[model samples]
Target: MRPGYGHTLRYLGAARGAITRRQPIFPTCYGDALQGSPVADITADPQSGWTGVHPAILAMNCLAYDAATLGNHEFNFGLPWLTRMLSAARHPVTCANLKLTCGRFLPPYLLLDRMIRSHDGEKHPIRIGIIGLVPPQVTSWDHLHLGDRLISEDMVKASRELVPRIREEGADLIVALAHTGIDTGPAHPFMENAALQIAAVPGVDALLAGHSHQIFPDSTVPGTDGGAVDSAIGTLSGTPAVMAGFGGSHLGILDLALRRHHGHWTITGHRSEARPVTSMKTGIAAAPDAEISRALTKTHAATLRLTRRPIGHSPAPLHSYLAMVGDSAALRLVNAAQHEAMAELLRGTAHENLPILSATAPFKAGGRGGPGHYTDIPAGPLKLRHAADLYIFPNTLCGLQITGALLRDWLERAASCFNRIGPDARGVPLLNPEMPSHDFDVISGLTYRIDLSQPARHAPGGALASPGATRIRDLRHAGKPVRASDVFILATNSYRAYGGGGYPDLPDTERIHTGKTQVRDVLVRHIRSRSQVAPPAGVTWSFASQPGASAILETGPGVRRHAAELAALGATDLGGGSGGFVRLHLPFDGPLASRGNDN
Candidate 1:
């Protein structure tokens, strides 16, 4: 999130912009979890964990951010760690929907008293109230850390309740920092994306939307094409709302025409836009801020040192370019690490007799982060930092004992990541837009097939889509069909076992063991325990064959280099795709496990 503070100062029609400027820029941030996503606040420095703040916070303070809010990723680390990080922010961090278990809540809104210059060279006083909101699904996504301690309320509901109070506090304007995306559909309780509904709230004058990382008012983006979002004018449901792109790629600017009607401050008309900060052809537009660079010198060096530490070796390349459609060497190595760690924890336990099924996911599947987001580690010596590329999140390990029926339901929920396809549907999208790539989990120790022609049993948010519907075909273990009454112990990360993805909820009794060790550490330990680690032999799941059907899978453009890999799976390269992605025509003609990690 390296943005040029000086460029923003020049674009806003100010002769001088600094600590003494009276025009008031009102520089507010939509929200991102942590700095750089370079392991989200983890560094080689000793004082940079739970007790110390990340360099990103220091950069924000140096750049002078007025206010900010929480994103779902903010809850990835436990509460103690998050509380320590927020204490370092120079600006107020507000979120109306977040409630703590101690019968208290974080700052819901901020009342800022500012002065703006009039047309006749006079200064006018304005009181602006900014209320913050995060997605209610934060609890589910970080269920391990947020287990009953923290609860997230619905976005629209919180706005309805808090906006009136802000107005009662004698504020002229109210802006909502809604960390969500624009949705034209009907508003429901506990919905993850709800900017369109929050915009319709009576007292809210304007809103800054985020969370999906899709830029509003941009016709080329996927989520902004809805009817409620007038992409031409940057308005959501007639409210002046703006959603900038992620990682500081774009800046959301909202210009309001202030008018005094009968002595009350009113907004007549406004201009809104999401401005790109850097161009792909020309690189960064302005000089790098020296203050920001100096503040991050120590952390940047520490991070580089952390990423370069060596671990072990690999015989074949590990990449996630084909994770969405086929087997992944990246995930295969993670599953092995998770299963090995859980075995040592359950060696003397009473549940040791039960079989352990390791569940892992493909984190770098080229979703919103663009085509270059996938992990592509070359064969040879491995480094400690490669563990970060393979296992992105800072999640801990946990083991859960559940019946076979619940396991099937878990896989069914993961199956909701794809859309329903018919036998005759050709060249349709292979993925569901509402589902994030992290929710697509591939569990090991079981062989199953997902039927794309059938409707998904659950929706993207874990709601029941079809009753008695089955998308998992022929679930089996050890070459035998699994029964509903059979029992198994699943070793997974705290996010999934406690409730990270929209999987089913299990009680405390169901959890056999929850380790305090991070999954990345377990991966490091597993790799070091062997002379040279190799990718798993076979895949755990495959697509159920559908005749004369095909789908398009968007991935990194680098997939073209693996020509023999694509030929083995009978996939066709559709060339460059929209939004800087490459398209692969998936015909489902052969088993995905037919090929290994070879070029």
Candidate 2:
């Protein structure tokens, strides 16, 4: 389905119209069918009717798309369910790298024999080969579900091997549907951004890329070589490419002009671009397609009903506008839920005696998702939608055994979210824009302060930058300093525990428990189990005092209402920042009056 919101029906219609009158529109997707809904459970299976991507599949079938590819998120519900869903599509689902350990077969690529109209209005028969490749990181991201059931190959390697085979199968041209991002970094066996390398593969004519949720044909992206990307004229190693922005935001279009020479078809020229569904200047979106609206009426109604059902209550509001600045109630609640669930699961196990810690980050903090992305829930009945807002991904819960030193290192890596501040650099920006909000993790059950003056031990992407530098100070458990050898059980999602975000000190062998339950489901259950849930009041961590030194931070516009609360944490309202974010000035020497109490 349309992931978040936009007029997908109208977007698709516009995309269809962009092509030549007699040419067929090729629609492709890069996985992740659930969790993008403004309403939750649109991907959930209700007792009475079909759910998840069923409606989206129906819409695609109605549109008569030629073929599609798999994305990493497609396996969120597990392999069996994903297989069933893919099989239900009228169009072929092709992936060259995915392999099933259970002996289940999925074609490595798809070959389409179709007729195309040239500039002379003459139709020519052509065999077009489409190959799909997803990042191999899926094996780690979905380890619990796909551990023994399936495996994935490196995108570059898979493409190199499959492109020639597809060419030999009498195909005139080849198109790669790579669920990867474009980067000019040195090639690695399992690098996430392999689009450039994939493009260099022989016989590949055009490429459709995704998974970075970024738009090509835009000049915003910084290439790996430290240069601005001319996204508007997107290309990877001279091959025309387009990455449609996520969630129907844009449609990637690539036009190839072909010619027949010596009984062989070859691409002579090409053009590529991405079209947005919403107007950039006026902030207006296209109208929804009446036909698609009519087609999805029942499913949409059911999704709304299911998401609005009251599930629990919160004694205090849960918001994350100022999450990166101080202790966030929203993240605190999530940590509590993970801790509670993990504790219960280990009650009778040998590991029950170990202290339980939870690792959580503010997923809604404004970044790539834009300023309006913060989570703000009023104190009252909580709906499933609220829970989904609290924890966005469908990531499964996992418990890891780690030493105190390792935990400290983990926190140090997370502390890289902030920029190193100079003693006299008051009002200097404090955040590292390159660091994603998801990677700025805060650990519950431990008290520590991040000294922003010190160089961070790790870079934003989680690589070790300064091994000897220590930004985390006063790391303690139960009011006592944690020793390097002290062991603890950490409740985190499979992604972090399995080293998905480049977090250090965690090896998969250290995993003590992997729950089948999704973290969002755990949050819902935890909220329902309590009559009134509230985060412990006080700061878990705070900036080290630097008299007269101030730093600026950006948050959502709605944070103005909580100005006094922010002041208590040493932040003064300074109005707006760039990109719809509100700016706040925090004095390092100010008293931490709003610090939460440690339990």
Best by lDDT: 1
| Per-candidate count of clashing residue pairs (backbone under 3 Å) | 1, 12
The sequence of per-residue lDDT tens digits that candidate 2 reaches over residues 71-178 is: 777777677777666766888878888888865347889998876665456556778898988878787788888886787788888888888898899887788888
In candidate 1, position 321 carries an lDDT of 87
What C-alpha lDDT, on a 0 to 100 scale, does residue 66 get in candidate 1? Answer: 82
**lDDT per residue as tens, model 1, 339-395:** 888888989989888999998888777776667778898889899788878887777
Q: Candidate 2 versus the native: TM-score?
A: 0.89
**lDDT at residue 587 of model 2 (Cα atoms):** 78
lDDT of 2: 0.75
Cα misplacement distance, residue 15 of candidate 2 (Å) = 23
